[model samples]
Target: MRFFKLFFVLLLYGLSLLVLPPVSSSEVVWSISARVGDNVTLPCEAPGVVDFEDVAVKWTRPDLGPDQFVVFYRDGRPDPDNQHPSYQDRVDLVHSQLMGGDLSVVLKNVTINDSGRFECQLIQKMENQKKWSESKPISTIVLKVSDPDPIEARVGDNVTLPCNTSDVVNFEDPTVKWTRPDLGLGQYIYLYRDGRPDPENQHPSYEDRVDLVHSQLMGGDLSVVLKNVTINDSGTFECHLIQTMMFGKRRKRSRSESELLSTIVLKVSDPGSTGNRTETGDEGGHEDRQRHGLTGSVCVVTVLSVGLFLSKKAKLSKSF
Candidate 1:
């Protein structure tokens, strides 16, 4: 009976090893998009992290220059020997979440230079076991950076709306679209393709007012200039691009629709009386005087006071 019991225990242990999976086989990937100056959290966790306080976790950014050590942990504390200087005070781990199989880190004050792929690796140590099993990439986070701030402009003045690409642009078969949500769909402010504006599909209000003033579309400049802007032009403007690429030895053509390169807010303000004050004319002066309640009677009283003082001075000189 003792021999049988020992053999049974060995059999169970052998079966457990066969059923257990490798750490490298399990990995999670997540995509994150954020604007400039934002705080983001990158998650990394595994079911195997339960009850393992001694875990080795390291985050790295291979795309960025020089420094790759984003965060490194060993024996329950962070190691700062090879940490990147740019991420020194900006990166931190959540210990509460880490206890629950989560190795997530919160990055503060994110900048455009921080945009790239981030990899998280973890290894949990068994309590009674001498050997530690390292977990593969628990998470692969891709951070895409963009700037979505509004651009201010004044009415009756020309304004340039900026939108450009970081990659090479093919202008031969390019499609650029500028649309405003307030104007509804299909009523684009400007539509350019094959090197010319598509006036047939353009909105009548922006018929001759919109132009691709960049003059260097092929050089990757997609900025547009609006001439004689109106108050109605104030709204969100989206710039979409679609380009064709030739690939492979056969030179097969492929079309890839680009994401909205940028969405610019056009804030159109009326020139108002403030701007009209610059005109050098009597009408402008008269309007300004009325606005400030500077009546003609106040000016006449000042002139009479000066004349009375002059008459008194002549009488005093004769007496002397």
Candidate 2:
């Protein structure tokens, strides 16, 4: 039978390459968490590979000190000659998908020491043999160093809540508290020493309402300015970080607390009115002011115009 059908198609193509199943390569799948100008996305998942679109991509940092290449490429041609000037221009390598090898990466304006640990590399060259496709073991993104975003005023509207902790340079002076829980009292607006603004221990309804307080206990600009906001101000605010933990030295001094809230929801207008309607409050304030008063929107529009002209004169005297 034609030599048993050509040896049964070469033993079914070598038993389908020994039952196939083998394509596990491509790391640094995805990992991201940021805050500092905010703009990040790094995901690289290569598999089985096929025409690596002229491979050659590198982004390193091997964990701070040493191996901080940052950027590099050759095949796809993008090797700023061995890039490293602190990642000139901030770093970028997302060449339109590069034939699906996807070496995604994008960073900019983030400051908090730029947080660390990042590596996405791939180098594959044919024609002779030059292979290397790595991905996992290294792919970490953390830029938690924060301070910014907390400002919304109304009442008397005179805000300057600039609690922008400029990427902390470590001088220690970030424990500013402010809360107006239903007007019960919870002050102490500013206390940043060594750089100014330490009004004794301030908190007499904001003593002077704080202003232009330039604080930088090393780099955290804990700004403050709340000129006039009424309606009993508002609540819920936090600006984290207060550390002091050094095990193995009999020492511990930690304190990470960041809270901010200067809300003022108060806009008043009416009060006391038999039933002509007008009672705004869920914060639009209105009730109070009943100092022996009763609203009279023009006597409720002349008693609904004399009860609609006596019901049209009793319906024309019952239609005559």
On lDDT, the candidate that comes out on top is 1
Cα deviation of 314, candidate 1, in Å: 37
**TM-scores, each model vs. reference:** 0.44, 0.30
The digit string of per-residue lDDT tens for model 2 on 262-288 reads 222223222233223433342233334
Poorest 10 consecutive residues by lDDT, candidate 1 = 46-55
After superposing candidate 1, which stretches have Cα over 4 Å from the reference? Answer: 1-147, 245-256, 273-320
RMSD of 1: 15.3
In TM-score terms, which candidate is top? Answer: 1
lDDT of 1 at 135: 53
TM-score of structure candidate 2: 0.30
Tell me the TM-score of model 1. Answer: 0.44
